[model samples]
Target: METTFDAADFHQTKLQNQLIQQLAAVEAQSNSTWATQQGQNSTRLAIALNLI
Candidate 1:
């Protein structure tokens, strides 16, 4: 037998895609910020230890 899909399923799929995209954007931004902070901290530590 053939099955039929509903509007609700389509809406749910769209919402899921939107949520996934938003999450990916936020995660990328967070990773960028974390990397920047880590680099800054490393520089400060090196300066303090006269390594550079």
Candidate 2:
């Protein structure tokens, strides 16, 4: 029982670490995309206002 519990705990910890790393990567990508979109939106808004 002790050995089984230890193995399971180790595996769970590893999986948690992997999930955390993946989530961090996704957050970074999302932030980068958002920044790019905001810049485009500002440029578009400026052009539209100028046309008006």
Top of the candidates by TM-score: 1
What is the Cα-based lDDT of residue 42 in candidate 1? Answer: 96
What tens-digit string does per-residue lDDT give for candidate 1 at 1-52? Answer: 8587789988999999999999999999999999999999999998989963
Q: Compose the digit string of candidate 2's lDDT tens values, residues 1-52.
A: 3445677798999999999999999999999999999999999999999999
Local distance difference test, each candidate? 0.95, 0.95
Compute the lDDT for candidate 2.
0.95
Error of 2 at 34 (Å): 0.8
lDDT of 1 at 47: 95
RMSD (Å) of each candidate, 1 decimal: 2.4, 3.2
Model 1: CA > 4 A from native: none
